[model samples]
Structure formats: structure tokens, C-alpha cells
Target: MHHATPLINTIVGGLVLAFLLGILANRFRISPLVGYLVAGVLVGPHTPGFVADTSLAPELAELGVILLMFGVGLHFSLKDLMAVKSIAIPGAIAQIAVATLLGITFSTVMHWTLVNGLVFGLCLSTASTVVLLRALEERQLIDSRRGQIAIGWLIVEDLVMVLTLVLLPAYGKLLGGESETMRQVWLDLALTLGKVAAFITLMIVVGRRVVPWVLAKSASTGSRELFTLSVLAMALGIAFGAVELFGVSFALGAFFAGVVLNESELSHRAAHDTLPLRDAFAVLFFVSVGMLFDPLIVIHEPLAVLATLAIILVGKSAAAFALVKLFGHSRRTALTISVSLAQIGEFAFILAGLGISLGMLSPQGQNLVLAGAILSIMVNPLMFALLERYLARHDPGDEETTDRQPGEETQLPLEVCHHALLVGYGRVGSLIGARLAEAGMPMVVIENTRARVDMLRNQGINVVLGNAAKPEILSLARLDCARWLLLTIPNGFEAGEIVALAREKRPDLSIIVRAHYDDEVAYITERGATQVVMGEREIATSMIALLQLDAAKLPY
Candidate 1:
């Protein structure tokens, strides 16, 4: 319990440092994490400036990691976890085991003690979920099978990371203390695991019951900040409690707490609230990591760094590819997933700190490892990007995203091509869908509704369930190639924004905007919109057309 001044200093410093470095990193096309590391090194005791309390940084970093994992769990619903589990679990396990083995081999070759080698291996086995998820999003692969498999693989890595955090320390202690009995070590390890299990059970049973009620009661305050604070308290409190009382790793507790909240209505909201802080704190975690890098190691021990990088990438990726394929997948899918996940993560940051505290490895060795971690963090995204391009070009699993409508899109006024574009798939969207199916033009409907996604999918149509306003949805529809964009939502404000956003991306897109008011018709027309339909005008236009057809039937 220090005063407010230090707390403010720590937060303000971390945030300012993060923002500036992040911008710089962005400008350079480098991982902002590297910037965070650089920022930490500058502020660390090794430098002359306002040195932060050494422990303060990691403590704050723990907050970031916990929130990040919590956010991951919150968004990674039970459905998603189960959906991807088939590949993620197995892929993750094989990757970790292989990477760890490789790390151990390298350390052993370097004449490290057996314990040090194993610890080194464990650290190398994890991947930064944050970096990978962002990369997946950027590459727009989140909806693909490879993305699903990659996610599942990461879950396995996370589980292994937790186990290593808890079990490795005991192993290290028993190995180091010649007098410590094997029986004693086993007892401690078992107790630790039991406590971890019980902690998980308690969080699931008790927390599931309590958190929703808390969120429900608190949400009416209509204060986003309060909601954010509540989420933070729950995450940090459980994480800290596990460490203080049950002797479980904070990472495990944080993850379990996130799992408990997976069932809550506020899961996504909770995730949104925690992300900014997670990002800032996560940056510190990376930055603190950078401070540990001794420039001398790279200069004098070049082989060590090169060897570590090789073992992490080539050895781990190969292991992952083989294990995943053996488990059940095409070689292409397995290779793509494994290759993408071949790097280290923030968990290793915690592990490195633990290793230093336990004196298991020399500071120099730890520095080299931290340097490697930063380099990996920086490189992981680029590697994933390269792998994505390679998979797209070569793998069947790398199919380009397309919006398959449940049925055809029918409209009063429209353009037609090899495909029909359904802008909104609500009740109106669905009705148009049925008509289009009858006509048999390849129909492509883009919708924002989640419930109808599977419903449409069940009907053998390519249903893109996302914001139609986004250029990605437009590109998915192949707007330049597709002849029409059927806009169903008649809200003028949303329509304008969507139109603007679309035009910004694709200037020649032909959209038939659905309008409710006469003023909006003028507004839409003035903007050079292709067409606008008023609800009243739709009935009138059909009535006149029907009359004309009736007159023609009279043989006039």
C-alpha cells in the first residue's frame, strides 16, 4: 500500500511510454512489443532516468497478462473452444512438446545443466496468443479452418504454459537441493496440482454463479468505467488470491477466472474493457523483457542466439506439423497451423522472471533468452503473414472467403450478375432470399445478424455473418465483380455511413439503398447513389407496373 503518487507515476509512465513507442514501432513496421521493450529498457535501473521500482513493472505486467488471457477466454466462447478443440488441443500439445525438446537439446549441447535445459525448453514452447490472434485478424483468416485450427493449438499451448509454471519450480527445487527428498518433491507437486484443480472448480462453480449476478446488478449503473473496474477487480483478485493462498500460479487463476466468465452475458463487454489496459501492461511485459537483453550476448555469443532461434522455429514447427497430421488433418492444414504457431509468448516472460528469482540460470543466459523472446515477438507476426500467403497459394484449406447467401436476393430495382448481393438478411432479407433462390442466379447475401448465420449456412448458402458496412464484406462479395448491393436497413444515418465507408473503399460500387423518408431519398441521390427505394414508392411502383401488364394482357 503505497500512496497515490507512485501508482499514478507507474500508470502514467507505462501509458505514455507505450503510446510513444507504439507509434514509433508502427511507423517502422516493427512489432510495437519491441517498442515496449525498448521503453522499458530506457526506464529500467540500467539506465539513468526515473528508474521505476524494479518489482513494480512485473506486478503491472501480471495485470496485463491476466486481463489478456481473461479477454481471450471471454471471447473464445465454449462454442468456439469446442469448435476448434479438435485441432487446437492436439496442435498445441505437439508444438509445445517438440519446441521444448528442441530447446532442451540446444541447451544441453551448450553444456547447460539438465534442469536449465528443460526450463529453457519449456519457455520456448509457448506462443503469444495476442500477437497471433492479431495477425490472424489482419490476414482475415479468422473464419478459415486454418485459423480455427491455430486457435485450438494455442489453447493447448496455454494449458502447457500453466502446468510448466506450477510444476517446473518444484522440479527445479528438487534438482537443486541435493538433500530434498524425491518424496517431498512429489508431495509438493501433487499438492500444488490438487490446489490448482480445486481452485479451478471453485471458480467455475462459485464464480459462474456470482459473476453474472454482479454484472447484471452493476450494469444498470450505465457507467462503463465502473463495469471496467469490476472486471479488473475480479481478474486481479482471483489471480492474486490463487498465488497467496493456494500457491497456484497467477496465470492459472487468471485463466480459470476467465473460463468462469465465459458463460456470462458481459463476456465480450468485459473483454473490451480489459483490452486497453491489457495492451498497455502487455507492452511493459515485453519492454521489461527487452531490458534483460544484454547487447553483449548477441555480439559475443552469436551462435547461442542463432541456435535458440533455429530450435524454436524449425524444430518446433516440424514437430507441430507431424503431431497435428498424425492426430487428424491433411499435411497442408497441419503444416500451415504449426508453422504459424512456431514462436514464444508472454508466459515465457513470467517464466524467465521465475528462473531469475530461483537462480536456475545465470542473468546472462536469461538475458539471451529474453532477447530471443523479444525477437520472436517481433518476428511472429511476419512469419504468420508469410505462412498465410504460402497456405493461400498452395493449400486447399486456404480457400478465399466468399459470402454465400442462403437463397437469391430479389428486389424491386436491382443489378444482376453471376451473384446477387443481399445487404441485409433480416426478415426482409430472408424473403428476398427465397425469391432469388427460385430464379437461380448465384446469390450472395451479406448480413450482420449472428443467429441467422448458421441458419443460412444450413440451407447450403455462403452466408457472411459480419458488418456489411465493412469493405471486407464488400470484397468478400467481390463488389467490383458483383453487380448489385441490396441495402435493406432503412435507417438514414447508418445508410449514410455504410455508403460512405463503402465508397471510400470501392468508388464504383452500385448500391440500391432502402430508404424510409423522402429527405433521405434526396440525400442518397445527391451523393450519386445508384438508386434509392422508399417503402411507399415500392408499393406504388409495383402497382403501376402491374396495371401496365394488365393493359398489355387486354391486347392493347
Candidate 2:
């Protein structure tokens, strides 16, 4: 009984190594993406170690692509894209053109054919959505004008790449042989487009009604496991059906499935429920890409690796900066957008793989793309750090400071003064918020959950959506103007950080924090919490008071 399945071995090995490296990367203040790639290289065939099953890795990586695109579709908002269309659409197109041109010039210098050059160029033209979103969310910039513009631009780039993915095979066939005429190429393209259009129409018309109904039924059962299973089934089922029936890419099918599901009220739960699986597969996707990379490229083809990095870090960034500035935006906006786009990730790897499958890209090109992705991801945080410093010194009155004022059409009340700033809208915080609302007291909630924020807003409660640990998010809650800061989240260390920050921002602000342990209470209080309420301590106090009352009621 030979039970040593290669699939199991690959998954186990990849995940364990990736976890170890990811932690190391975080410890060093580097993106976990860099670590994941490094892990892949370590377990790769090129390295002196246990190699994973390369054959199964790609299939798993495809699943990751489907789930990743589906998640994107869930968060996708046409309204947000339209709001910044004037700048985002044109700026993204122009930047992609510039990047592609630079990539093509480099490819030509390397003596590649025009078709190969175009494929290579296309890979370099787009930025990684995962990296961009993580960066923006970490900085609490996801809702800012600058973040909106950058996100909108990335959306445009994604749509273009999706279209390219659909059309590339036909283009490849035409370029590969004389048997395929230009007319044949156009005909094949039209047929592919027709299938895609038909698939999208089915999703919008029928899927929109069916998916929500399925989820609603699943929700009615009140089974968390069933609901999670239903969401995953929808994602994977639609992806498979699209390829089997419509001759479309799994990524496109999964994306449209997500867009359809996004219309349902259960969409947030769907996203949250399936996040763990999505994240796991996404990591595997990165690991698979790393497996394809040969570290000797740095030694054997250093110039080619450098050229790829230049296109990603310098050429693409310069184009984005020029495009944003040409649209009459400020220097800060230009810099933000530029730095945001200065890395490549999942999409680049997907494109590179497709190019290789179609015989349009060489092994060397794929390795170069992988090398560029790793290096650029490693350098991205430094770029952001430099930008932050520049803004602090030169643009001292940047948006974070100036935009804190009320009457900016924000959810916070303009007339409210000495209001309570409530952090975390979970169990304890929600109870406190309900009491304050009943008493007609002014309150603003700082919560990171989007679904909770939406619910609060619908009830006419003011809420700020972001991690409260960040100063910018706290600033958005107007800490200086707040009279009381309440930390209802259970994490003692995190709560302490928030207390310290609030105290520094407003020395006179009263702070109350909840803790689960006696040591946590002491820790929070030492960090400047005016009051630390421990659950066990309060329970004991109530019990003692009740015992005394009972004794007094007795004859004694």
C-alpha cells in the first residue's frame, strides 16, 4: 500500500515552508509575498531539497486564480470605478501602453520575436491587485481620493488583462503558423468574444437570481458549515461550468460568479467565510510561481533580470506618475499612484504561464518575470516608506491632517462635541453603543468590519471603517475632539496600543478598556488607560455583593 501521494506531499511541504518563510519575512519588515516566493525557490527542483509535485502545483495554482478573481469580483464596485473614471481609465491605459513599449524594447534588445515581445510586454504592464490592496488597507488609504484613483486604475488594468487572456490564444495561433489566415484569426476572435458575451449574459440574467436564492435558502437553514460550503461550491462550480460550456477562462467565469453574488446581502458573509480557503490557495499560487523560477538567472542572465526589474519598478512607475500628473492631479497623488503600481504579482505570473503554454514566451522570460516579481515586492515597502517621509516633510498639510475636519460629507456628525469614540463594534462594544444611542448621546464607532459598518450606517449610526490601531483611522474618528475613548475589543496588547495613541493625541481624553485577564488589566492601565475593566474581576465583585445582601436578609 503505497500511500505517499505526491499531491499530499506537495501541499504539505509547500504550506509548511511558506509559513516559516512568511513569518521570517514579516519579522524582517518585508512583505510575506517575498517569503512565499523564496519558499518556492527552496523547495523547487533547482534547489538541493525535497521538490514538490510540479504537475499538481499548477492545477492548484489555477484554483487559486479562480478564487482570487472571485474575491475581487465580490469587492468590485462599478460605482467606485465610475467615480474616478475621468483619471483612472485614461491614466491606466496610457501607463500600460508605456510599460508595454518599454518591455517590447527590452525584448527586442534580447532578440525575441515580435509576438513574444508583446506577450512579455503585456505581463509587465499590470500591477498586482493583492499587493496594491494590502498596501492601501494597511495605510488606511483605501477610502481616500488617492486610494480610490489607484484602485480604479487597477480595475481598468484587470479588465484589460482579462480580455487579453481571452484573445491571446487566437493571436498566438495566427502568429505561430501560416495555415491560419488573418480572416481566420478575426473569426476565431469573434467566436471567442461571442462565447464570452453569452456566458456573461447567462451569469447576469439567470445566475444573479439563482445564486442569491441558493444562499438565502442556505442561510435559512442556520448552518454555518452549509453556508460556507454553498459559497465555495458557487465559486468552484461556476468556474468549472464556464470552461466546460462556454469555452471561457476559469478566472473570467469565477469573476462573473462573484459579481453576481455581490448583489446579495449575504455577499460579505460569503467573502468572510471563504477567506481562509482563498488565502491558502492564493499562497499555493505564489509558491507554484516560485517553483518555476531558477535562482541561477541572477548569475547567468543578470542583465535580463535587471531589465525586467527596471520595467516593473522604474518604467511602469514613471509612466503612472506622468499620466496622473498630466491629468492635473497634485504631486502627492501622482506619487501615491506611481508607487502603488510599482510591483507585479498574480496576473504577471498567469500571463507568463499562458505565454509559455502557447509557446510565445521562453523559459528564460518566465524566470525573469518571477525574479522581477520577487525583487519588486521586496522593494515596495521601502518605496512606500520613502513616500511617507517625503509627504511628512514636504506635504505637511496632507489629506490625513486637513481632512479630519467635519462637514466633509463624512458619516460623522458635524455639530457633535464631546462625543464618545467607540472602538470595535463587536459584542461588548455593541452593547455600549446601544446604551449610548438610547440615551441620545453622540457616538462614533471605529470598526474594521465592512458589513458591520454598513449595518451601523443603515441604522443612522456614525462609523469609521478601518483598523483602530492605526493613527490615521483613529484620526478619522476625531480623537482630539472626542471626550471619551472606549476600547471594547478583547485583545489587551492591541487595546493598549490604541490607548497610548489616543492619549498622545488628546492628553485629556478619558479612556476605558476591557480585558480578559488580570495581567491584561494591569498592562492596559500602565499604557495610559484611565479604566481597565476585567471580566473575572467584575463577576467576582457582583458575586460578593450578592452574598453580602443575602446574609443581611438572613436572621443573623
Candidate 3:
């Protein structure tokens, strides 16, 4: 029995195309988002191929946006933002204003209305969180002073976008209204602000207390599936309820739900559990944006497309550079900040989608936004690569600069010397770290998880906050004076990379790595790992020794 399943077909088609193109993009060293967007373009109504059900894509895309926002809220760290507030806050605002002005100017030249121009400008003003973070991570700069500033700047942009999402509809109505009085506009604006404030306050005071408790109880059941279900329910339920009761957007509701849940210790687990779903939905979100994009716009309106790209890549970059430099930061810092934010991504799509739904922005405007996004994302990695090469030639002392604050380094004490490098802080690494502590060995730990990093810091354990695969992160451990490089992380392929780097740095350094399988053991060993501890082999050996001891006791 065959079924005419529009939803199933849309999902299957989207995922299959996304995976194929995503792999291709990754192979070419481009962002996977580009591939997902391209996949949408191929399968869209505008293209000559199997078209996904257009009616179903947008609704799925909305779910994707909600999950993306929830993930953002889950990872939000106020402390990180506060560290770079001096530059990040003012810098982000000024850059947005500049980008918006450029967008509005282009719109004026194209004969669009001011309201449409405003919506278009706002969409162009923000950069992709995913792209910026991935770039920083690749270079091992996520914990550096420049990285912190970039992240804080992004947080400001996100908060601004959230507020923009809430006020845009009301603003649209106010602008479009012919019969509305000044008093009525004021009343409507005040009412909207009041409702937003009420939602935030309620989430902070009540939802924080209740949401975490519910999650904790779910987690206590020892059922991973149950905990995962609880998280989804909270995210989707709160989003739906916020629309019904507080009259806010789903994005805002999901964002608040995540923020409330973040207060829980199990928040990390919740985030880890929901990551696959969030990523799937996020991919759908990009695909939906691409589906709306008309490729012939580039052919028909080449000048408009170029202008939009200029606003994003050139205008926005120039504005950010000027702001960062004006704040008395180093030129390197300014360049990094500017180039890192030269592309627009998910938020742009979300804002444009909202504008379309409100009848504020034309389809032409949405098409332009999508075109700009695809082009900017495709070019951003090249920009980063050039920036790195340029910086390398101009400035050799990138890390030892005067701009780095004391806290920018890991919580390791300055006096600690000749410490071993311990990568990972999970179940296996934790046990290993405990043993190392008992042996009175001073060591530095490399970890990626926020929760684990916090716990390690609380215990006065020195830790670097990034993946060990990045050479810059490994360098932070002072490998020159280190006695041992312990790759306790579970992934053997990643461990192989670390081992290779360590061996190249210091041939005499003791290197140890963990493996789960025989193939992993062989791979790590081939990569110059001095020791490979296979868990299954060790378990069998221990069991045999215990059996021998039992047999000896019986004979005696």
C-alpha cells in the first residue's frame, strides 16, 4: 500500500539532499549550511527537480528555528558577555546601525518603501552564530581575549534580534495604519512591551523554579529517552503557550524556556540529548530559506544582489573594524572582529520569514536576503584564511600580545610549571584525573564541555576550554615543559591527531591514548602514541587475574 505522504516525502527529500550536499561542502572546506541551502534550491519550486512539498517545509522550518533558539539559550553565558562588554556592547550596536543604514540606502535607491527597507536592513545587520563559532573553534581562539569579544558581540546581536522580532509586527501595524490615532499606537506599543516584560519576569521567577525541577525528576528516572522527551515538551510546549498566553513569538518562548532550563545542573545533559534534533531542525530552517530564494534574482537583479552582498561583507565589516579600532583595541583584534562577522545566517532568515508573514517585506526582499546569505557564507572561510595568513606575516606574537587579560588564560596558576597535559574530563578522564591527583602530579586538563570545565575549575584543576585537535589549544598546555600528554578522550581518531602533534613537538614526551576497539588501538599506535589502553583488553586481563586469585585460594 503506497501512501501520498507529503510530510514524509518533504523530510526524507530534505535530509537526503542535505546529507549528500553537506558532505560535499565539508569536503570542500565550506560551511555545511551552504550545502543545505543549495539542497533546498535544487529541490525548490524554482528549480528543475523533485520538489519537496512547499506547504510543509515552512512549518518544519519554524520548528527548526525554535530548536535553534532553544540551543542558543541553553548555551548562553552571561559571564562571558560581561567580560567584553566594554567593546562588545557598543561595538555590536554601532555596527548594526551602520549595516542597516547601508541596507536602507540601497532600498531607497531601488524605490522600496521605508518600512520594507527597515526590515531588510535589520536582516542584513546580524551575522551567523554558527559560522563565527566554528571559525573561532577551528583556530583554537574560543577562550582567547579576541574570541571572548567576538562572542560577546554576537550575544548582543542575538539579544537585539530577539527584541526586534517582538517589536517588528507592532511597528509594522503602526506604520501601515491609516485610521489609528497616536494614543492608540502608544497604547499598543506599551501593551506589547508590558506583555514581553511579564513573560520574561514569569520565566525568571516561576519557570526557572518549576522547569528545572521537572527536568531533574525526569532525569532521576534513569531513562535517557524520558529525559529527552521532557526537554522537547518544555521547548515546544512553552513556545506554543507563549503564543497563546503572552502573545509573543515562538522563538522568544523557546529561548526563555531554554534560559529557564539552563539554571538546572542537568541543563548540559538536556542540551546534549536534544542536540541531534536541534541540528536536524536547524538544517530544515536553512533549507526552507533556500526554498524561498529565487536564483534568477541574481540574473535579473544582479546590481541589487551585489548591493545586498556589499552591505553584508563590506559595509558591515568596515563598520565593525572602525568600532573595534575606535575602542583602542589592537588592529589584529579589530580585523578579526570585523571579518568574523562578515556573513549573515539563520537569524536573517528568521527575521525575513517574519517580515513575509507580517506582509511587511516583499518576496523580492526575502530573495535578496537569501542570496546575500549564500554568497557571504561561501566567501567567509576564504576571508578567515586570508586574515590568518596576513596576520601571521604581520604579527608573529599573536598570543603573547599585551591585549590578553589574565583571565583569558585558563584558571591555571601562573606559577604552575612542568605540568602534564590531560585531555578530556568525562567518566574515564575523571577517574584518571583522580588517580593523577593522588600521585601529587600537577597537570592541566583540556575539555570542551562547559559543565565539566566549570566543575574542574571549582576543584582548582587547571583546564583549557576547547578541543585538543586544535594545535593552538594544545600549545596552551605548555607542551614543551610537560612530562606527559594523556589523551583520555574517547574518540581515537581525534586522539591520533593530538598524538601526532605532540610527537612532532617533542619526540621524547610520554604520550598515552585510550581506544575502544582494535582498529582504534592500531590507528593511535600508528600515529606515534607511546601507549594505547584498550578498555576491553584491560577488562579481560583484570577478570582473568581475579579468577586466578580465586582458584589459588580454593586450592590453599
Candidate 4:
């Protein structure tokens, strides 16, 4: 058989299985990632049919992670991380430390080898951004306060994961060599870290600036194929540079490269553009991880796998929930945020694979980690679905309430409302929607902009495509039952007329009307509005409310 034929067959088989399983996953309300991992396990070499040649799988897996980190780096600016530095840096370190210590403790009790136990801890320490991000995106909660904080916190974990990869190889190499001493191992470890530090400096000074320019230049050539090729080239180049030049794994280099590019202007473009390739390669990475799982090991060491998963998902979530709540979000917000961060992420695959290569993990230990990864990815979405339902009942407005950033009204409309009725879906309407959403109120948003309506719809928000000042629009919004009506349009005369008309019709409609300036307030008031809320006055009132609220009692 031609070498290319087996590779092609393997990829084709895996993809087909993945597609089928993904369909099932979606239909069943489960994450498609679960299906992808299962597909990998089914088609892997350890199984019978369509066994993928995994020798190249790990290398390809490296590209997948690189693309992922590249997207992360391009978007995750140090400034953003620094903005949340108080939480991200400390939260990431603390979580990893706690998880690792627990893993080590469990391993000691189970009598696993010290090296293998360390590998176990390393594998279990980090959360999977891919799993969590996908789940949040699926639910349209990606821009929420909790989601933003979770992403920032994940970056911190990525930093630690990268450092661990750089340090582990040297430690593991000692076990494979003849008559190695602990002192030499420590020295190699020091030198390995030093090399990584130097490599990071070189990348920052050189690769970060150069790579984006290379990508931009390629993009300017007006060739999609060329642009795709360029992304891979940069990712591979950095990965190769780290491994061949610095003795660090390609994943480590890829990560630092991403961190550097995170500071660039092209981060969002890079993320949006390279998604297909990242997803394609990312699929292969998970499949490769699934292939690493051994059923026999689970039969023999089921206790270990369960123990590890329990500590990682549940124990870790508890810690994160407490940490986030302490940081000032509501318990509901903290719960959702913590649940989102509960699973071990795709990057764990990278760390574990490197550990396997470096002899830090025994064959069984590797299998255990692989199984844990599969299970975690599988349950992440379900866990989120459960959590969402739980929060809806217990904390209905958590995501929307925590979400505050606004933009030109988008087509996606998943905005939650509270005691407010939004009239007009213009910039102000959408901005107010975002704010009211963060406050956890059920709001009925009325808008007439088709493009904006479409954008709000896409965002999974509650919206009516009509003028709220109209009687029919007000009726559609169920204004008779509404506690507050927010009017945000430029037609003061039209609004005044509508307000007069509404007062005549309903007589008890409590409406908050926005005016351009103070002089318009009297006319608005004369029209029978309960209150006139100028944008300026509203801001002041909100600030006062914020000031009055107990910061210590803030729900994250």
C-alpha cells in the first residue's frame, strides 16, 4: 500500500465517523466534541477498523494546538490578561496547585510510582478552553462576565501548562538514560527552563512581530490558499523552532508564539480566519488523544480514573466557584463560571502527550489521562446544559445579567430581559439591552432595524422587530404587564405623541423615556411618562446604585 493511502484512509475514516457522531451529539443536545473523541477511540490503532497511523498524529496534533494557541495569542492580549490579573494569575496558579496536590495525594494513597503520580497531577491540573469555550459559544454566553473571566483565567493555566512542558522533558529524560542522578536531572531542568526563557525572548523580539507581518502580507496577496498556508507555516515554524532549537516541545513554542501575537492588532482576524484549519486539526488532536485511551487499563484501574476525574471536575469547580464568588459576582454567576471551567481542556492533551514522550508517564498512566480527557470533554456540554437549566431556575439572569459590553446592534438576539420593555432596536436600545441583561431582568426589546434585528436574533436575544411607541408594538411587548418601558429613539415629538396616546389607552403604563437634553424632559413629562431618564442622568443613577450596593455581597 502507498504510504499516503493509509494516511488518507485514516483521516477520511476518522472524519466520517466524527461527522456522524457529531450529528448525533447535536440532536441529543450533547457537545460534538464528545462524539469526536469517541470516533477517535473507535478508529484508533488499538481498535480494529481504519486504525490511524498515530506516529504522525502527535505531530499533526501539535499543529492543532498551535493554531488554537495562535488564535488565543492573537486575541488574548497581555493587556486583557493584566486587566484581570488579580483573578487570572492568582486563580490559575492556585487551582493548578490545589488540583496537583490532590492528584499527588491520591496517587500516594493508591501506591502509584512517584514519577507517574507527578505525570498524573500534571495531566489533571489544567482546564480545557476548547471544551468550555465551545459550550459557552453554543449557549451564546461567550461574552458574559463569567465567560470573559473564565477565558482570562484559562490563559493563566495555559502559561503554567507551557512552563510544565518545558520543565518535564528534562526530568523524564533522566529515567530513560543510564545511571542518571537527581542532581543532573535538576540541572537539566534548570537548563531546559533557561532555554525556554531565552526562546521566549527571541520570539517576542523577533517571531511575534515578524509572524503577523508575514501573515498580513500573505493575506494581502488575495489568495485564501496562500493565507492558510502562511498560518500553518508560522505555527509550524514556531513549534519547530522551540523543539529543534530550544529542546522545548512544539506546543510550548506554539503557545508562546500565540501569547506574543495576542498583543497584535490582527488577533481577531487571525481567529476568525483560521477557524476552519484550527477546527480541522483540532479534531485530529482529540482523535489522537482518544486513540491513546486503553479500555483494559480502565477495567483494571477504574478507581484511579474515577478518583482523578472527581478531583478534577468537581473539586476544581468548587474551588473556582468559591474563588469567583469571592471576587464579587453573584453565587449564580460564580456557579455558571465555575461549571464552565470545570473540565480539563484540549491543551491537556498537549501536556500529557509531551509527558508520555518524556517518560514521565507510564503506559497505564498515559491511558488513564487519555480516558479522563475523553470523559471530561464528553460531559462538559451536558454539565453545562444541566448547569444552565439549574441557573435558569435558581438564577435566571446570571449570564445576561453579567453581560455588559454593547456594540452596534448585532443580528443575534439571545438577550434576556427583566422588568424593562425596550422601544427601538437601535444602538441605544441594544446597549440598554446589554445592560439590562447583565442585571438579570427579563426585557422585551422592540427594534425596527432589519440588520440590527438579525444580529440580535443571532445573539439569542428576545426581540420584537417593530416600533415600541406604536400601540400594536406596545401590545406585542405585553406592556400592560411590564414594570418599566424604556423609550430610546430620536423622535421626541413622535415619542411624546405616543406617550400621550399610550396614557390615554392604558392610563397606568409606567414608561421611562430618553431625551437628548434637559429641555426635552418637560415635554416628555407632559406626555404622561412616569419618568424621563436622560442617558447622562441614567449613568449617574446607576453609579449611585453601584456605590450603594455592598461590594462584599456582589454576585460574580
**lDDT for model 2:** 0.81
Give me the runs in candidate 4 sitting further than 4 Å from their true place. 1-4, 140-144, 169-209, 246-269, 345-362, 398-556
Candidate 1 lDDT over residue span 472-526, tens digit each? 5566665656656677763555576667766666577787787878998888766
Could you give candidate 3's per-residue lDDT for residues 188-280 as a string of tens digits?
667766877898889888998999999989988999899999999999999888878877767768877987776466765677678788778
Candidate closer to the true structure by lDDT (higher is better), 1 or 4: 4
Model 1 clash tally, residue pairs: 6
Candidates' C-alpha lDDT:
0.68, 0.81, 0.81, 0.70
Task: Tell me the deviation in Å of residue 80 in model 2.
Answer: 1.9
User: Per-residue lDDT for 163 in model 1?
Assistant: 64
Give the lowest summed-lDDT range of ten residues in model 3: 406-415
lDDT of 4 at 149: 71
Better of 3 and 4 by lDDT: 3
Ranking by TM-score: 3, 2, 1, 4
Which stretches of model 2 miss by more than 4 angstroms?
1-3, 62-76, 176-184, 187-213, 239-272, 400-413, 422-435, 445-476, 481-500, 506-556
Clashing pairs in 3: none
